[model samples]
Target chain A: MSLQASRNISRFWEWGRKIICVGRNYADHAKELKNAIPKEPVLFLKPPTAYVREGSPILVPLYTTNLHHEVELGVVIGKGGTAIPQSAAMEHVAGYALCLDMTARDIQDECKSKGLPWTMAKAFNTSCPISEFIPKERIPDPGKVNLWLKVNDQLRQSGCTSQMIFSVPYLISYISDFITLEEGDLILTGTPKGVSAVQQHDELQAGIEDIVTMRFTVDRQDH
Target chain B: MSLQASRNISRFWEWGRKIICVGRNYADHAKELKNAIPKEPVLFLKPPTAYVREGSPILVPLYTTNLHHEVELGVVIGKGGTAIPQSAAMEHVAGYALCLDMTARDIQDECKSKGLPWTMAKAFNTSCPISEFIPKERIPDPGKVNLWLKVNDQLRQSGCTSQMIFSVPYLISYISDFITLEEGDLILTGTPKGVSAVQQHDELQAGIEDIVTMRFTVDRQDH
Candidate 1:
């Protein structure tokens, strides 16, 4: 799709900043990707352009032929702070939502081979699709939550947040140690295993336990 | 260093929202990084938290035993717009500066192993050190500007923007295609060869041909 489709949704939450993501937070996903579970949290970024509403169509760019879908849980920042203690991180969270961290596996692979950056592969248009906000208080303990995603009603990924290698508090603490978290920011917890490529017209649905669900479709664009 | 050391540079002009970096933008760096020169631009992000102003103390984090410096010319966005044409790209530029894209090579390597996101390796605190602003009009042709960095009086990285894989306008056009450029956002046009590690207390000096020069020191703290 053309750049016109890339708009920042952060304004809705008063978040005028970046979306930080945690990678391989789940044990199964790490093993499936053939990566070792880290002792600490792993962090990454998804530019504002990547944010797409849950109902929007995910455009498949013509440049790369292999595009994949990664279903993740998104944490919206309610306040901005630095070096926040793990015990106090929950106070900073505004809400939660189900998100998809789409990737161009081929392009990312090439970049990895050359010791390069992953922005093009991760921060493209419609790369992230998120559900409406679910206030943090509703989730009680995010770590115990169950998340699942299905394509055309066929289950693709099903895992509980309990399987995450790093807990929510740890991620918040670790991230703040590196960068200051700001209002309207989002932290996309890594996806569980079952990430795979999708074709045009594929109907995707993702849900977080009894909390919320999101539905979307893939489309092909001329640009 | 503690979060207290995070200087509040909230002036929209002073705080760059995102630092878009181009990897393998230079042919030699592509070779040194052991990857083929990409047919298209390789993009990545270094968040605003990574930003360190001219003469700001760059604290070497304890987690990264091997931190390296990547000196490159920086492009500051003046006007924020999307789908900007190559011819009109310069109209959106605010200024230029000298910057260091600091990296935690070891952590980045680990991320490369598990196909993880590069945030921990790239978007760390004090990871970006930038010189004072030099308005775009000052440097008639940013593509031809010369950039270099020195540590404690020893020259480390020296290169010219002429060697870039994507010209300034092209980069602006390409980045805007997916990510919308905002006022105060910085685009780090990739680094040159001779990137190496530096120790605590080392002095770093970087500059662009005739525009801006910056001086800073490495800070080592117990925390």
Candidate 2:
């Protein structure tokens, strides 16, 4: 297979390893879903094939009926490190992107109940939709930006990063302690409240302040 | 970063995406662990950083008191496909490797009880130890091979591929229906009967019918 450049980052990087995601980072979001606030970050993963860029529609997997859109701020790692200190974590970030963590809620719930892995629910193709990246310099304070998402032109989620239970640097430090963070690896900071089911032909838009914006359409998988 | 050859596979392949795994694919193994026989294949994942070779030591994560070794066969994908049929699945096979799915049983049990993702329990660095790849032709009958692991000359896991609940082709087909498979990606067939903990300086030797053999030492994380 030929090497391909990342859709957003201009530095010509490939999807190095995995897309690590944090769950229940925002108090209100966790409360909305009736989940206890986690003492530490809850983590999951999406394979590289889950990546979907603009101009392509997010295909709802045939196995899931309830697919929800979770808007999040994605931290793209520029440098790789292990056991990185929190004070110096920011030095490893290359940029940021607006992302949607499309989830198969029904499948996920079933997996959780049976103590099974969440691969089918979170790691399907087109499960992640991202916007063009904004260099870290552009978003001087990643923890204080406002991010929102709209479904079919109606706002569904609106929140600020300040409400996150864990900060970007803290997550980087926490994750690198166990899983080595490599260049091109992405960290999907957890979503906020107002996550709802999306269906075929629905148009979704999301942005982070004015730094980056993205649009996507949902379609059912025919095969 | 420049592309590097896979640690075990000699065909100059890069770590494509995820390390997809099968759990409870052997009924005897499931019974040994007191887990019910799964109706379908149980899936999980390990990140690329989890890949470790013979000379390297498997570091015991500081958080777990019970770390067990699961010996299994690893299939390397040479072609990428989605929703592929079983008849065509074998064409995608590149080769096979003897692998160890190191598990933190204590942490995994906690995560399972809480209905949480197993990222912490399963995706840590050095969680997977692999032997050099044996080309597909060398193992023409993947379903009829003997795999064994010995810890300090005491036999732990002894099993044969004939006992697998899910044949490799069926697993590849079933997995592709939900998760896309890519070249250089690995599929860890589930382990069999015996599993026990290892400590610092423990020597591990595993092999597949004299076709390929590898040895590793265990060490505790100093930090």
Each model's TM-score, in the order given?
Answer: 0.86, 0.95
Q: Give, for candidate 2 chain B, the lowest lDDT window spanning 10 residues.
A: B4-13
Regions more than 4 Å wrong, model 1: A1-14, B1-16, B30-36, B81-85, B109-116
- Candidate 2, B84: how far from true, in Å? 0.9
Give one digit per residue, the lDDT tens place, for model 2 in B149-217: 999999998999999999999999998987889888899999999999999999999999979989999
How would you encode candidate 1's per-residue C-alpha lDDT over B76-139 as one tens digit per residue?
8878887788999999987877788898888877767656667777887788887767766789
lDDT of 2 by residue, A1-223 (tens): 2243322354312455779999999999999878899999999988888888999999999999999999999999988899999999999999987899999999999988988889889989899898886788999999999999999999999999999999999999999998999888989999999999999999999998878889999999877
**lDDT of predicted model 2:** 0.89
List TM-scores of chain B, every candidate. Answer: 0.90, 0.95
Candidate 2 regions with alpha-carbon error over 4 angstroms = A1-13, B1-14
How would the docking of model 2 be graded?
A: medium
User: How well does candidate 1 score on lDDT at residue A109?
Assistant: 78
> What fraction of the genuine interface contacts, i.e. the true contacts, does candidate 1 reproduce?
0.52
